[model samples]
Target: MVISNKSNRRHFIKKAALAVGSALLLGGSLLPASVMAELGEPEKEELKFGFIKLTDMAPLAIAYEKGYFEDEGLYVTLEAQANWKVLLDGVIDGQLDGAHMLAGQPLAATIGFGTKAHIVTPLSMDLNGNGITVSNEIWEKMKAHVPMGEDGKPVHPIKADYLKPVVEEYKKEGKPFNMGMVFPVSTHNYELRYWLAAGGIHPGYYAPAKGDITGQIDADALLSVTPPPQMPATLEAGTIYGYCVGEPWNQQAVFKGIGVPVITDYEIWKDNPEKVFGMTKEFTETYPNTTVRVVKAMLRAAKWLDENDNANRMEAVKILSKSQYVGADADVIANSMTGTFEYEKGDKREVPDFNVFFRYFATYPYYSDAVWYLSQMRRWGQIAEPKSDDWYMETAKSVYRPDIYQKAAEALIEEGTLSADEFPDFATETGFRAPQSEFIDEVTFDGTKPNEYLEKFSIGLKGEEVIK
Candidate 1:
């Protein structure tokens, strides 16, 4: 049904209601009796969701296109917003029911970093969909320092150590080394900072307590915000030397012959969590069943995205290439979505997990993921003051609602829509992964110990250290 047309939408709804009535009479409702009893009919049937035009917003697109939202009795309208701030504001002011948000948006909002609101996420959208790219000139200069393999190509997982000399060269010439990230609290920002610091370059600090949120307090590289879609153009115009963003923007750079992606977030931190499906706490409380239903539909969409070794990825890429979706060239969107990522012009490599939507329990909203973002916030001075380990745990619990996710997963399993093996065993699940140690710098991260995690970083705030 073409939901974009008002007449067709009304017809679709009428047909859907009749279909449900017929199923009930035939003792074959879409959901099993037990599942239906557990999750009542949705309190609200219509919803409008917001997202940025990045490839990671695939789950929402897939849900709407594949009719998963309709399966849960939701008529969802997916709108692409201008930028992250506008998207967040839409949700805050009721202009949007929910949105595809940076993993840190809800946490940052709840903690009163930029805006104060109680935002929550029941589902993580996708994982490992971002890369750091540099302008062609920067890559040309840095290539001299990068180690080449026997194949005469640069070695895999190109470390920022190779870029340090280039940054130093710019410093020697008294030129400001500037880079771009999608937002202050975005994974792109933290990932870029992590790469730079690992190479002995300071990405700088944020001192909100001293009213300095520039995040370039004591820096070697000045990182600023540039929306994802504008990344390639901004680079071509030489407005920024490099940027960390999600596809197909990174791939767009390669296609435009303007830049080269040095490393993907997958290389920085394997299977790192990315975007989340965010809604205000008030919306969830006022319409609990609607919230759970929304999750159920997205779970189905996420599963479809990663099932059969990503067999559906090509179709997803086509949908994303639509002007209303990611709005990039099909080949460019397929470059990363199809399991291969292009670093340089002809240096494409297999990165099958580059844009994970469901495999590895990606949709589950783990508290550990929340803790990681919170730790980065504190590490970068977004939290302003030192927070206790218990405080990190409390904050993570408040924002990442695994409880809501569990309900949706269980309902899907009970209805035989998804199998039990596809999910983490809720019986033994603690909403935390085992201590993660896959970072590019070889630093181990134990989510339970946020302070210790911060202490391990050389270029970030730690303990009682404030930006004095």
Candidate 2:
């Protein structure tokens, strides 16, 4: 009888050990001698984290399913929330310790944009795993302007200008065209707006100051925030003509035959940062070691996702396909999860970096990346007022938290869980990628020279320019 109760007995002991160890190791730096002991303390060992159903949430899924969290002395329960907002709410209200979050979530929360909190991320989840899709009706309308490849599919990086005629036709017909993005401050919002504006279509502006939340004024395609998982259903219901969203969701649209993804953000900006694992500033301060441990687990998962030329991605897709994770079919998840993306059902092409987790410094939190989002916020009037270059730099530092990230990464290196070559050389890194000139319009962006780069854009509010 006693032996039969062993499972419950062991569970209780693990919890007791975690609580006792966490109390002792809360602030102890994870030096090799200390982490062995520190690993004993979870304060609370059983955790429930939330994520929206998207492939970019793979780090958290991998960390949990692969027993990496357990290796760090953490027993996790990965729950798929209904949407990003509910998932974010769970983290803020203490229903979750942490979760897969938007890159802008920590920034927006800290800055009091949507919610008032000081959320911070030590780990960036991935890079370049999003695409803009259009309903089959819209794609058919826009098809005429797109140049064809020899095989007869529309060309790569299909400019939104091709859709301008269709939008104009809608306008002439007294109809308003609608588009969907994941969130108000999401990378999808900025990327879609950037692509549309670059193609000379007014993706519209936000006057949050006027109490009008409808981000559509003087717009051809009125863009609004729809949670990622609902994107396909919403498009199918004809609520939106198309939407920009992350993987599995957009790919779901293709599988369901509701829409077709036309262009990926990799085609928009090439290896742009996506989601991140975020925690509140208070959580970080109170559970410093725990936070580091969490980061360590996630880092290992991220590396494994990208290791040996994405050897783990197929396995990751299998894990992600479970009902508790992304909850999509394995084929839908693999459409973009394993290094290639499809457009128009059969126009699949190799995009090896589409869902990068750890490779190419993807996990590092860079001020330049923060500043780029800031620039977009200003461009679209979300900031509500003009801000100086110094303001951008300071705001970036406040949200990005590169210092915290470096500490966590170094601990992993010292623990021998990862190699030094996996990260940028801290002594020599400038936190900026070289000027990238891969846009359809041929505009170059040097992260170090943000102001200059902003000025080069014919569109967008630059320098002392204010959106009036």
Candidate 3:
């Protein structure tokens, strides 16, 4: 939980590098000793950042609490914003220099979906830290339909299809089933949709051109926006039957005995990227070294969080339990954290990548990751028409900046703040991951083949189609 000093940044790199036994990975060219000694100073040291009450906000919390910000000669104040939009607004209006953001927020905004701004991310926060939860009534009804264990606990990573019959029942009874997620462009929205669609349920669409942004057109389950902290209260009051959101709110429901969490996004799409650290393109340009310094600190914090194979997560959960950060009780936070994610009241299972920080290059802003989000945007009709493959690639490159990430990574390596082996082979790295087939639907997603990937999905609008 400690953000090492700048001098110590170098020290930890050597220690971590040696510990990993990959010290010789950096074969000389990337960071010469001359460049290593040229650690740039922060241009604007004092700053404000914002976050929601989710556990994935831990990197920012870790950075601040551990003095990673100070280690870069930057003084920072971390504030919890009222909601996603407000937090995004703060960043857009210059009230916040940067903030922990929904991975889709910057992408959506950049593409003119909600509040249009040219926001971009140099740091992806963490991977697969969200889930969908249902009330006790829904869980009770959903259990019988779901495949169960020999021990009879309803073998999980439960599909929304289990809930689909229930939703159909509601429809047959002339009733509506509703769910809440944090935002239209949120990972929760896509995960919920993906989960539902994978189970042969139509989660609905967005016909923005028709002046319908509700996204419930031709829907079985109606999904709407509810802020993260409000998820527990809203579900408790029966305002929503179920919700898709991040921690510790899902655990908050279990603490309140109001609901059961059915599935985590890690279970939906393993190691799916979540929130990221975002600022305007102008902000990074106005202060390049400061931006890299910020990423360096965050990278260190991310590495510490994932180091020891998450041996430090228990202590991190304790830190996040503080009133200023997530503000949820320690036990509540620990439910889905600490390598065990819970479903129902007592069904906690070991899911180690539930909140990956630095391992597997989790923080790297890959163009493939950006393209996937854009594909979801297209699937959901956020983008009105069919865009060329080049459009997808170009848009991803514009928003997810691996070039900037490389500069930051290089600086850290040269300064000995991180070893060359700590990152991918920069020379051979293609900012795109190989086509992946880990989704709940078993649909292959090749970032290079977006349209073809979309064509494989049975639920989403693929190719040139539109929801009328």
Identify the candidate with maximal TM-score.
Answer: 1
Clash number by candidate, in order: 0, 2, 0
Score residue 50 of candidate 1 by CA lDDT.
92
Write candidate 1's Cα lDDT for 71-188 as tens digits: 7778787888999999999999999999999999999999999999999999999899999999999999999999999999999789999999999999999999999999999999
TM per candidate comes to 0.97, 0.90, 0.92
Cα deviation of 360, candidate 1, in Å? 0.4
In the range 88-143, model 2's lDDT, one tens digit per residue, is: 88889998888888888888788777788888877788999999999999999889
Cα error of candidate 2 at position 2, Å: 29
Which digits, one per residue and each the tens of the lDDT, describe model 3 over residues 252-368?
888888999988898789889999999998999998888988998899899989998898888999999987888889998988778887777777788888889999899999999
| Ten contiguous residues minimizing lDDT sum, candidate 2 | 1-10
lDDT at 224 for candidate 2? 88
Which stretches of candidate 2 lie above 4 Å from their native place?
1-31, 34-44, 464-468
Of the two candidates 2 and 3, the one with more favorable TM-score, higher being better, is 3
